[model samples]
Target: METPPQRNANMAQIFHRSTNFISRFSLFAGIFLAGLALTGVLGLARSPYFTRQNVTRSQPVQFSHKHHVGDDGIDCRYCHTSVETSATAGIPQTKTCMSCHSVLFNNVGYLEPIRESYRTDASIEWVKVHRLADYVYFNHSIHVSKGVGCSTCHGRVDQMPLMFQANTLLMQWCLDCHRNTEMALRPLDKVYDMAWRPAANQAEIGRQYKAERNIRNTSELSSCSTCHR
Candidate 1:
């Protein structure tokens, strides 16, 4: 029998060409998707919503941290009273500002909101600068007690006329600090000092504090459960 004049060679060649085209197309598609994904990630990282640098929101009163903390030498705990005792750092009430501005700048135009809030017995709606996700459980009291200074996380508020977020407040950033806590640890007395710097023997001091406080290992501190749970 003639058997259809030997068609196997041509059929095999067509099948091979089709598969090659599909493989090439798939490779190109994968590369395109990877590039797009990388660009998106980079854009998000640099966006104002993520970086949060120099991003200030207008509040009921235009309070300047530089004026209050830097020029006036006000302690952070004075306004954020719960920083040392709670997971959330509480916002200052109108009474807190009136404690000083009541007599100092009571008639000033900028102080009108403060005066109004105080008179109305309503809390001043101070805009939050540093905020974390609800899922992330960060305890300011624990961080403060562990010798992490305010500046270690909050940055130099004393120098900021309008407070803005300094750190990214991302999980990776927290993990980095947790992995290397010594770099941020300070004397417990200097927890509120925003301009504190590491002294000559700061590392040794940090080690001593870590031992005294029985800080967990880096692996424990960087665990997902540490923040997520």
Candidate 2:
């Protein structure tokens, strides 16, 4: 007589072949969604909203760079006094404004804050436009000495009605210039020129200046300590 059916043979299947496909699809979909989410977060971090590039901010006094620098031919150093010799670009004191406003537009209603600041011996709480993280250390004098122009990072301030950040000022943006610095170097005399443009032979000129100025190599400039410290 035939033996009774084995227990294993009689056992029913718990999962179907389609279950394999469903499991695989679920795993891949989760991975894809996770990757997409990560990419979106990174994009948002670098966006204009986060970086504040090209966004004009209101100041305590509405100082117009366009009128001052473009129309009046005022130099940047008149306001940012320590840019050439100090790590920080010193903000223009109330006296600096009084030097001119005391003669020109002295009685203007908008400039009442300036007169008040001078009289009270209190500093104008001017809002800073181009701000960097506290962890990062930037030296204005070092970059100025390296033949980098004011407009290179600050953009065309002479044309700006209100001062705003012209670039992302991100670490990668800095690295791009550091890796190929020859392209950004300008004549030292033209450092403050807002209308300065790259000449047809700018590449050649830049290479020459880079060599003469003894700028550090890409590896050095891109190092962590270069900007962090």
Top-scoring candidate (TM-score): 2
Q: What is the C-alpha RMSD of each candidate to the true structure, in Å?
A: 4.0, 2.8
**99-138, model 2: which lDDT tens digit per residue?**
9999999998999999999999988898888999999999
**Which residue pairs clash within candidate 2?**
none
Give the runs in model 1 whose Cα sits over 4 Å from its true position: 1-30, 42-46
Q: Give the lowest summed-lDDT range of ten residues in model 2.
A: 4-13
lDDT values for all models: 0.84, 0.92
- Each candidate structure's TM-score, on Cα atoms with residue i matched to residue i, is 0.83, 0.90
Which portions of model 2 show Cα errors greater than 4 Å?
A: 1-21
Per-residue CA lDDT of candidate 1, range 56-132, in tens? Answer: 88877777889999999988888899988999888877788889887896788978888888788877777777777
For each of the candidates, give the backbone clash count.
0, 0
Alpha-carbon lDDT of model 1: 0.84
